[model samples]
Target: MDMAKDLRGRKALTARPLRLAAATATAGLLLTLAACQDGGADRADDGQASIVAPGRPGEKSRTLTPEQAAKAKPDDSPNAADQSYVQRMIEHHRQALTMSALAPERAAADPVKRLAERISAAQKPEIGAMQKWLALHPAPTAGSGTTAPGHGHDHDHGSMPGMATEQQLKELADARGADFDRLFLKLMTAHHEGALTMAGEALAGGNNPAVEEMANEVVATQSAEIHRMRAMG
Candidate 1:
């Protein structure tokens, strides 16, 4: 009887360790499964949709979820194209203003006079807005001279697409009545088309949101003006 009881006790001790080992393995497996589930949840939470994130200096760009990208600051910094377009466009508008200035006294047709008045009215405010924008966002002066290449104060009239020559302006200024109307419409049409070209370039190349908005407005307004001028002829 004593031998049987000792045998039974040893068997029970052995069974306990086996049960303990099984329990430990089961607990470890449960922990591992829980960690895997948590990792998947984290990935799901980060957002499923991926977006291209611009890289930092010396870093390669990486794909990110919209949620992750939203954490980053927005970049609407003006590019060189934006600056050039704004500066050149200001000069461009000034020429239009000069042309329109002659219309009230020189233009014979009522329609021509009214068109010139509208152009002047629209452009004057646009000039103010562009001037304000330039003031707000000044060009970098590093390594640049007193007058930057695309500075608002200074521009290359020859480089601009639609600018009238000295002789053309002289002709317009000297002419009166029907002659003035004809010349003005023709010159203004070419001028507006040139503006459209500039605006299109700005839209394609510029980075600044404000510049983009300005360029789009120019395109819309000038396109309408072009149609009107063509219709007048």
Candidate 2:
């Protein structure tokens, strides 16, 4: 009788922890899902989905190729805007990785650091993909590599919205504690906004599938993140 009672007691002990664990897991799942849902999507004043996030005061659209520089229609040919978007986005994405790499040291909190790291991780591969596309469709230089239009950009400004200006980056480098947090949020927010601008233009004008895919991704992810950052603030 004692042995049977001991066995039953052990089963009860094991079952109790399992039951508690299940309940805890369920609660956690509910909370996480709730957070995701509450984050919500951005809508314009007119109720359109805001593909571009909110911007700071200094935002500007980087110049694109003019119409005369473009290919003769889209029938089996890449256009000038398409080529410029790919090349510039590749450069733009590289800068994102650069900024993301600095986030942990500059971030004020675990969440900010993680978000920056995530952005960096996601953009690195995209940089490589864009480079690959360019390699396959070489800029029409001395005619060696595959040729594309508007092969040269005069400024290479890295002009996207969320991008850290040299001065802002310096501020980020010098910041610590809450200062770091605020600067990071402000800088990254602007950086993301700039990417959204580029993406929006691409969606409206570019014809490449890869270009469209990256543009859509930028819109969706940045839109969600803008809300998350706003909530965090």
lDDT of 2 by residue, 1-233 (tens): 23223333543443434334444544444444344347643444665332221122375412112231122122324555567777777777776677667767667688888888778777888788888887876555545444343444543554544566788777777788788788777777777677777776665565565666666676777666766776666
Q: After superposition, which runs of candidate 2 have C-alpha atoms over 4 Å from their true positions? A: 1-76, 142-151
Candidate 1, pairs of clashing residues: none
The lDDT for every candidate, in the order shown, is 0.75, 0.61
lDDT of 2 at 94: 73
Candidate 1 global TM-score? 0.67
Local lDDT at 92 for model 2: 73
Candidate 1 lDDT (Cα, whole model)? 0.75
The digit string of per-residue lDDT tens for model 1 on 130-214 reads: 9999899887565665333564445677679988999999999999999999999999999988888787777666667798778
Candidate 2 lDDT for residue 233:
68
Ten residues in a row with the worst lDDT in model 2? 63-72
Candidate achieving the largest TM-score: 1
